[model samples]
Target: MSLVNRRRRPPAINIVPLVDVLTVLLFFFLVTMQFKQVSVLNITVPKIETAGKNEIKEQILIAVSAEGEFFYNDRPVDKEQLEGLVQLAGDTTPDMPVLLIADEDAPLKHVTLVMDLCRSHRLNKLRLQSR
Candidate 1:
């Protein structure tokens, strides 16, 4: 028999060990994973992937357009209407965060007005939603 033609062991790989290790890692991650409750109010924001990321409790969102229009939770409201809404939210949850999302072309006075309104309600946990 030729030296190179003798019995040669076929190359093989054992995948059982790899599968076992992967399963163990999956279980470890699952055990350590934390699931959070997303609030219904979260759906109102547009393309806001990271807004109020660290805020666990439901927050109040105040949006200002470039035309100095005020929107509370996506509903167009006047200053007095916004005040009532803010007061209601603030009274219900004292520690709720207020997220301010303003257009780039929006006037500074509109932003200031919303900020002032939030402060009046004693909703001090404020966050400016920005990219």
Candidate 2:
């Protein structure tokens, strides 16, 4: 065969693996990261026999202390105020998720009162927090 000059193409950098790794990292961070709601009250959340991971995003944090005091988003509120706040939130965002943080020693009636108010205001997206 006659000797001929052959042109060689430059090596291409593959980006598929890098894209895959970035996608996996993004998913890992998104799945593990959650919104942490800080409460001013020292209410002990009740414990459950199940997992502690929550899939629902809490927009309104309603805390009930062992003494049956209500707190709305870390701010102390009375029963009437709580109802008004819930009503306003429900009117603004009907599907807003509400997280109830009640002390383990809190009475069942107190917890149910908050639940009843939420339901009355059409804010049924409620989830109970646990220790």
Candidate 3:
């Protein structure tokens, strides 16, 4: 009987499929990611006894200074302009949440005025921010 010798092939791993899956995951995360813009206002929010976490995604930020000034998204806005902005937001997205961040020393009148504006515009999802 003649003995035959066979050559053994080295073990190999297929990486093409792994690379495709990684590429798909990267694209998925990049497409569905949400970016938040940081607020530049120096607001000293008041402390609260019980404050729940705010999980609303789309929100309009209104800042009230201690001196009774109003700011929308960090930009100064007068009473009428603030009302117009609230109205526009209500007309566009009625259910959109409004976040009021007032300074600890801010007057109650300013806060009430913003609340009134929101109520008049029918934007009922109002969240007051506190420390």
Alpha-carbon TM-score of each model against the true structure: 0.58, 0.69, 0.69
Colliding pairs, model 1: none
Residue 60 deviation, candidate 3, in Å?
0.7
What's model 1's overall lDDT?
0.79
What TM-score number comes out for model 3?
0.69
Q: How far is candidate 1 from the true structure (C-alpha RMSD, Å)?
A: 8.5
Candidate 1 Cα outliers beyond 4 Å, as residue runs: 1-57
Best by lDDT: 3
1-131 per-residue lDDT for model 1 (tens digits): 68987898899999999999999999999999998643333223334656545554577778888788888877789989999999998888878888887877778898898898898888998887664
Kindly state the number of residue pairs that clash in model 2: 0
In candidate 3, where is summed lDDT lowest over 10 consecutive residues?
1-10
Query: lDDT tens digits, residues 1-131, model 2?
Result: 43466666899999999999999999999999995755569988877989477777547889999999999998999999999999999898988989889999999999999999998888888889886
- Evaluated at residue 67, the lDDT of candidate 3 is 90
Clashes of each: 0, 0, 0
When sorted by TM-score, best at the front, the candidate numbers are 3, 2, 1
Candidate scoring better on lDDT of 1 and 2: 2
Evaluated with TM-score, which candidate comes out highest?
3
**Candidate 2 whole-model C-alpha lDDT, 0 to 1:** 0.89
Worst 10 residues of 2 by lDDT: 1-10
